[model samples]
Target: MIEERGRVLSVEAGAVWVETVRTSTCGSCAAKAGCGQALLSRVGSGAKRGFIRALTDRQWQIGDEVFIGIPEDAVVRGALWVYMVPLLGLFASALLAQAAGVAEPGMIGAALLGLAAGFAVVRWHGQRAQRDPQMMPQVLRSAGQVMPFAPEGRLNG
Candidate 1:
């Protein structure tokens, strides 16, 4: 299970909206100086405050802290959907366009068209997954279990 700490922004029926600072493990690691995630952290200084609605059984009040959990399988699947599908689409479309004896410009256009098609499929899949509980993140534990807040200086720069 992948876990994150967030503060409840609001509570509604069956779920709560949570706000969290986006951080990777490497961001807090002692050896961060050599970590790629640390490098990304340094570069991703502008990463926005992320918000998500998480299903929770426990009653929570505004600004209450909670831990959010997402399954590893779900994370892997999401990553593939976001990165791999478009790549495959680009290659497949280019090959198909070439097989059709299209000119170079046409081939480029076809590849781009394929990329769009892939993104379209991803969008459709995302809509469907919205209703799938297995893909959704859930409230895991209280703030006591996880750190209530991230390191302060880390967030600003």
Candidate 2:
């Protein structure tokens, strides 16, 4: 589970919207003196607001701090589909063409076609999954305590 502290901004039905702080690691960069990221960081200090939703069953009071967790299964399943499908498709297409006596150039074309098809499939699946409520992450609030996802002093409140 990945945990972070955030303040509740709004609650509607079964979801609570919370704002979390943003952080960056450009401060320690050896090229800070010459880097664009460092220049932006110096100018703005890099704090930003992000909203997260907690299920309605969870109780959250306005201005309250809460901890959130992202489930492990969600992480693993997402990884497998994103990385595995394309490679498998390319390999299968190449092997099939070779076995069928296709010329080298033709086989290469087939492999490229397979890779493109695989990427398309993965992208389509991801978009569909995002729209499905059952595929959304399950969020749980911490024990009546607000935890700052990013360090304090970053938010206006």
Candidate 3:
């Protein structure tokens, strides 16, 4: 299980909207300042928030700090879906075009078409996955649990 800390923004029924900062595990690495991940992180320029259903039956108050978790398989599957499949589609289509005697300029168009097709498939898959509870992140622990959390200033900084 991969876990992250978040502050509860609101509670509706059993689900709470939790606000979390996207912190890089490599933020302190020697090469981070020159890395594209760091650059993109800076470009995004803000935190992300999402709603997760409470795992336990307890009623949670507003402003409760909690830990959210998603299974490792879900993270791995999501990464593959978001990165690998589209890349393969682009390269495979380009190669197929090349093998079929397509011109260099037209090969680029073939790759683009493949990429769009991959994206369409991904979009369809995402919509389908949205209806699956096992694919969603869940509340792992609540504030009353024996976990120590830092203040907002630390997380924001």
Best lDDT among the predictions, by candidate number: 1
Would you list the clashing residue pairs of candidate 3? none
Compared with the true structure, what per-residue lDDT tens digits does model 2 show for residues 41-78?
77884456677775547656666777655667777777
lDDT, candidate 3, 17-45, per-residue tens: 66666667766789987799878777874
* TM-score-better candidate, 1 vs 2: 1
| lDDT values, one for every candidate | 0.84, 0.73, 0.74
- Candidates sorted by TM-score, best first: 1, 3, 2
Q: Mind giving the per-residue lDDT tens digits that candidate 1 earns over 54-108?
A: 9989998776778999999999999999898888888899999999999999999
Candidate 2 ranges with C-alpha deviation above 4 Å: 22-49, 131-134, 143-154
Model 1 TM: 0.77
| Ranked by lDDT, top first | 1, 3, 2
Which pairs of residues clash in candidate 2, taking residues 3 or more apart in a chain or in different chains? Answer: 5-147, 5-148, 5-149, 14-56, 65-145, 65-146, 66-146
In model 3, what lDDT does residue 70 have?
82
